[model samples]
Target chain A: MNLTAEEKGILQGAQGKGMQLALSTLVRYGEAFAADRMVEIHSAHLAGSFGAFIYRTYYDAIRLMVKEGLKVKVPATLNPRPLEKIKFLDRIMISQQGFLEASLAKLGVTPNYSCVCYDRENIPPQGAMLAWAESSAVQFANSVLGARTNRNSVTIDLCSAVTGKTPRFGYLLDQNRRGQVLVKVKAKKIDFPALGFLLGKKVVNRVPVLEHLECTRDDLKNMGAAMAASGAVALFHIEGVTPEAPTMKDIFDREPDEIITITEEELASLRSFEKSKPEMVVFGCPHLTMSEVKTLGEFYRGKQVKLPTYFCMIPRVRQELGGTDLLRDLEAAGVRVTAQCPLAAWTIRALGRKTILTNSGKLYYYLHKSEYGATEDCLKFSGVSS
Target chain B: MKELQGRGIISGQATGKALVTSQPLNLTSGLSKPWNLFNRLAAVYYDRHHELYKKDLYNRVLVFPQTIGSTFTGMVILETIRRGRAPLAMVVQQADTLLTSGLILAEVWLHKKVPLIEVPDPQLFNLIKTNDLVEVNGDTGAIRIIG
Candidate 1:
C-alpha cells in the first residue's frame, strides 16, 4: 500500500502496541477504500464523547491508548457529552464520563465539546486534509469550508489524530469531490434545515450542488447538518456559496447524474408535523454559534417560552455569549440554555420521550420523537416572536 | 443454494438466519434505546422509525443497505459485540466507514472479529429475506442463501 518507513515501523510494532494497533486499523480501513497511500492530516475532530457504562470495551480501548501515551499529533476537538445536566436519565449508563474526559484530555483534545469544531479556534485552511468524525462537521467542512476529509468513524477519527495520517481516498481526492447531483431549490421561503432534509433524502450519499438558493453561513451549516443526518452526505455545494462550486461547470464533471427540485410545499410537508404541537422545543443540533444565538435571542426578546424550550450551544460558544445582553435577555425570558448534544440528550428514553420541536433537521432525523419546524413556528409554539 | 459474490471488508465466516431489510440502519440511534439495557437476551432493534423495529439482532445475518447517522455507530456496534448480542455477521449493500469501524477495531485491538461484507448489487435485497438461512464467508466475499 506504499506505506512510508515511519508508517511501516508503527505497523511492525516499532512504536508500541497501541500505536501498532491504531496504524494497522487505518491501513485495513484504507485498503477497503482502495487507498494506495496515506495522506497527512492537518487536524481531527472526534465523535467519541459518549461515555456510557454500556461501552466498557470502548473505555478499555481508550484507557489502553492513554496508558500507551498515545497523543494526538495534530490539534483535535471533541463532540458533546451524552448527558449534560439531564438528571432524569439513568446515571449508571454514563458512569464513565469522567474517565473518558480524562482520557481524551491526556490525548490532548481541545475540550471545546461541540460538533461544530471548525467555528473559531481550529479552522483549517481551504483544501487542508483532515480526519474528522461527526457526520455534520465532516459535511460542513467538506462542503462549506472546502476542506478534505472522508467520514472517518469515531475510533478512526482518533487514530488519525494520534497518527496525523489518513487514507488518501474518497473526498480527499479531487475526482470524488465533484458534485454528482444537481439540486434545484424551488422553495420560496428556503427553510434551511427542511430543505437540507429533502436534499438528503433525494440524493443519499452523493455530492449535491444547489442552485438558486440565497443562504447565509448559518443557514448552510444547519442545512448541511440535516443533509448528513437524513442521508450520508459528507459534502455538498451551493452555486456560489460554498468554496468549490462557484459555477455549474466548476463543481460537476458532466451534466449531473441526477436532478431533483425541492419546493416550498415539499419543505412544508417535512415541517407538516408542526401542526401537532411539540411538548418541548430544541435548537442547535450541530451546536449554535454566537451569531445564531443572537438571532434567536431577538425572537425571545421580552418574551417567555410557552413550553420547555432549550438552546444547545457549543460550550465555548455559549461562554462567548456569556456577558452579552442577548444572553441576559434570553435568560430573562426563561429559555434554558445549555451546552449539550440534542441528538444525544433527546434520545434518552428516561426523558419520558415527549415529542420534540426543533429547527434543526439533523435533530428531527435522529431524535427519538422530533418534528421539524421553522424558526418562527418553533418560537410560536414556545410563545416567542408572536 | 443461492450464491452471490461481493467485496469483503472484514474477514471471517459465520452462518445464521438472515434478518434482511432494505432500509439503511442507523446503528447509533437504533440500538440506543433502553431496551438493549433491559434485555439480557439479545440486542433489540428498537429504532421505531425503522421498518425492522423491535426485532432481535442477536446471532442473525443482519442485511441492510448501509449505515447512517453519527460516528458513535462504531462504538454502539462494538458494545453489542462485547455483550454477545450482535448479529453473527453483517451483509451490507455498501459498507461505509461507520459500520466497519467498530468491527475493525474489535478485530485489531480486542481480537474479536465479526465478518462484514459489502454487496453493492441492488438486487441483493430482492433475493434475501428474513428467516432464510444465510452463510457468509468474509474471506472470499461469498454469501450463500442456504434455505
Candidate 2:
C-alpha cells in the first residue's frame, strides 16, 4: 500500500505509539480493501453505542499506546449515547467512564457526545477520509457534507486518529459509490418516519437511488437515522436531491445493476398490526429532533392519549424544550419527555405494554421483540392526521 | 480431552471457576428482562434493570462471543474492574477488536493483566460448555480445557 511521507514517518515511530498503532491499522485496513493510498480526515467520531466487549479493551489499549508517544491530534468526536446516561450523583455519561476518562486523559482527547459531528462543527473537506460507523453519520458526511468515509469500525477510527489517514476504498472510491439499486416511492411527499421505515425494511445493505422522495436536507437527516437503525446502509442517492446525485444518470454511477420498485402496499405490509387495547406509546428509537417533537406535540394538541407515551429527545434538544410551553403542553397532553430513549429505558415496566403505538418505524419494529403488546390497529386508526 | 492450544489475547479472564456460555451474544439490539443482563452480556445500553450478571465477582471467568452494544461499553468493563468483580480472562468466538479494546483498557486502568483469546474456530462452540475450565491463548488462537 502507498502512504504519504508523513504517514510513513509516523509508522517509522516518529509520531509516537498512538500514531504508530493508528497508521499500522490504517495501512492494514487499506490493504484489506485493496486501496493504493491514505486520505486525511478532519474529524474522528467514535462509536457511540458499543457493548462492554468493546469497552473492556479500547480503554486499556489507548492508555498503553499513548504512553508510547501516540496522540490524537485532530479534534475527535463521539456517538450520541453516553455509557450510562444517569449516574445520579456521579454525573457520568458514556459507558466505562473511569477507564475511558483515564484513556482519554492519557491520549489528551476530550469528549464531544454528539452524533452529527459535522453538523455541530468543523465539517471535513470534500473527499476527506472519515472513520465513522453510524449509518446516518456516514450518509451525511458522504452525501450531504461530501466528506468521504467507509463504514469503519471502532478500531479503524482510532487507527485513523493516530495515523491521520484512511484507506482509499469503499465509499471513498468514486467508482464504487454509484447506485446499484433504484427505489421509487409512489406516495406523494412521504412522511419522514414512514418513508424511512419503508425504505429501511426494503433496502438492506445495497446502495439504492431513491426516486420520488420529496425531501429537503433536514428530511434526509431523519431518513438516514431511520435507515441506520433498521438496516446496514452506508450510502444512498436521492434522485433530484443530494449534491452527489445531481441527475438521475449520476445516481447510476456508471450503469444500473438492477432497479426495484417500492410500492405503498409493500410499505404498509412491513409492520404487523394485530389489534389490541393500547397500553403504552413509545417514540424515538433513532431519536427525534425538535421539529418532529413539535409536530407530534401539535398532533396530540390537548388530546389525551389513552396510552402513556414517552417521547425521547437528545439532552440538548430536551434542554431546548425547557421553559417552553411545549413541555407544559406535552405533559398536559400525557406526552412525557424522556431523556433516555424507550429502548434505552424500561418505561414500559412502569407503564406496562398492554398495547404500544408509535409513529417511528424503528420503535415499532423493536416493540414486539422487546415483548410489548401489539397495537397495529391503533396506529392505523390514529391515521395520518395524528 | 482433546486439546487445541494456541497463544491468544485473553479478555475478561478469571482464575475462579469457569462459567462458559456457548451461545453467541448480540449487542446490536437492546435487551430487556431479568435475563436481559445475562442474555445480552455485551449490550450495556439499556438501564440496569436486571442484576443477574451485575458484576464479574464470580471467581470463574465468563466466556462468550463477540460483544455488540453502544460504543461507551468501556464503562461497563471499568465498573466490573473497580468492583473487583471482573473475570480474570476472556475467550471470544471471534477477534472483535472493539470488545477486546474495551476489556484491555479496563484491565490496564485497574493495573492488572488477564488472559484473553479469540477461539480457533466458530465451531469451538460445540466443544465448550458453561463452567468448563479452559486455558486461552490469544496470540496463537488456541483453547485447552483443563483435564
Candidate 3:
C-alpha cells in the first residue's frame, strides 16, 4: 500500500501511540483489500455507539485514544446508543453505556446518535469520498446521495475517521459502483422495505438496479436498512430515481448479468405475523427521521393501541417534535418514543419467544421473534384506526 | 490427513471441531445481543433464519461462504474473540470485509490474533465434516481436515 509521507510518519509513531495504532490498523486493513493508496474522506459515521461492555478490547482501545487526547480528524457521526428508555432493555448493557458515550464525546464526534446521518449531520455531496459505517447509511450515501464508501466495519470506520482517510478500494472505484443485477418490482402495493428485503435475499452482495419503481426518500431509507440486514447490499439503484443512475445506461454498461421480478405475493410470503397477533410493535431499525415521525404520528392521533408500540427515532426528531400536538398524540396513544437502535435494543433474548410486529424489514430480519407487518397492518394490529 | 491451500487474512493458528455450513452466516444477527454480560447465549448461532440455529460457535473451525448483515458484525466477532467465545478460527469460502474487520481489529488493536483462511473455492465444503477436527494455520495458509 502506498502511503503519503505524513501517513508513513504516523505509522512510524510520529503522531503518537493512538495515531500509530490507528494508522497501523488501517494499513493492515487496507493491505487486505489491496488498496493502493489512501483517499481522504469528507466525513465518517461510526457503528460504535454500543457494544463497549462486551467489546472490551474495542472500548479499551477507545479509552487509550481518548486518554491520548486524540480526536477524529474528519467530521464524524455515531450510530444509535443502546435502548436506555425502555422496559425490556438489558440493565447490564445500560450500565456500560456511559463510558462509551464519554469516549465518543472526547473523540470530537458529532452528537448525531442515529444511523441516518446523511439526512442532516454530515451530508455528503455527489461523489464525495467517505469512510462511513452502518450499512443502511452507507447504502443511502452511495446510492441515494452518490457518495462513495464500502460497507466498512466499525474499527475501519473509526480508524478512517482518526486518520481522515480510507484505503481506496471496493466502492471507492467508479467501475465498482455499476449495477450488477436488474430487479424489476411488479408488486401491486409496493412495500419498499419488503421489496428491499427480497432484493437482498435474491441478490446478496451484488448491486441491484430497480427498473420499475418510484419511492420516497423515507421509503429508500427503510428499504436500504433491510437489504443490508438480510444481505450485504451496500449500494443499489432505482434507475431513474437515484442520483447516479439518471438513465439506465449510466449505471449499466451492458444487459444486467441477471434479472429478477418481485411480486406482492413474494413479499407477502415473507410475512409471518398474519396468524398470531404481535405482543409489541417496533417502528425503527434505522431509526426514523423527524419527517417520518410526523407522518407516522398521524396514525395515533386520538386512539389507543392494544399492544405495546415503540417508535425508535433519532434524538433530533424528538427535539424537533418537542411540545407539538404530534408528540402529544403519540404519547397519549402510549407510543414509547426512544432514540435508540431497535436492532441493538430489542434482541431475541430481550423478546424471547414473544412475537414482534414491525414495519421495518431490517428489524424483522434481525429479531428472531419479530415478523414483518405493513404500515396499515401494523396499525390495524395495534388497534389504531383513521 | 487431507490438506488444502488457501489465502490467509489473519495470522494465527487454532485447531478445533469444525462447524461446517454452506450458507452465508450473518454474524451480527447470528449472535444477537451484547457479550458475556447480558449475552448468556455466548457465541451461539441463534439466527433463526439460518440452518445452524442453536449451534454454539465457540471453539470451532467455522466454515461458511461468507458473512452478511449489519456492519456491527465487526464488534460482535471482536467481542467474542475477546471473551474467548469466538470460533477457534474462521475458514471461509470468501472472506469479505466484515469478517476480516473483526479478526483484524482483534489482531491489530487487542493483540489477539484469530486465524482466518479464505479458501475461495466452493469445493471446501466437500472436504470438511461437521464434527471433524480441523487445524487451520493462517500464517502458512494451510488447512488440515483431520479425523
- Best by the DockQ measure: 3
In the range A1-386, model 2's lDDT, one tens digit per residue, is 87778778978878665666557656754553467987777767666333332344455456667668666766667554432345442222234655565565455454544455555443777777677755566767887776777666555566666656667777877886788888767754365655665565456556778774566665777666666555545678787677778888766746666667766665556444444444556665545667767866776666665656777665567778989888888877777776554553443233343555665555554445332222243333343133
TM-score of each: 0.96, 0.66, 0.94
Worst 10 residues of 3 chain A by lDDT: A86-95
Give the CA lDDT, 0 to 100, for residue A220 in model 2.
75
Report the Cα lDDT for residue A90, model 2: 24
lDDT of 3 at B24: 89
Candidate 2: misplaced stretches above 4 Å? A49-54, A65-71, A82-112, A122-126, A189-202, A253-255, A273-278, A300-305, A346-356, A364-385, B1-27, B30-147
lDDT of 2 by residue, B1-147 (tens): 556653365423333445565443323343332233344343233423222233332345556654433333334454445545456566666544344544554443455555666554666656766667766554555566774
Residue A354, model 1: lDDT of: 75
RMSD of each: 1.8, 7.9, 2.3
Error of 3 at B85 (Å): 2.3
- Listing candidates in order, what is each one's chain A TM-score? 0.97, 0.80, 0.96
Fnat computed for model 3: 0.85
Put the candidates in DockQ order, highest first.
3, 1, 2
- For candidate 1, write residues B1-147 as lDDT tens digits: 899998988899999899999988878778877767656525787777688899988889999998877777887787778778889999998888888888887787678889999999989899899999999999999999999
Name the DockQ score for candidate 2: 0.10
Return whichever of 1 and 3 wins on DockQ: 3
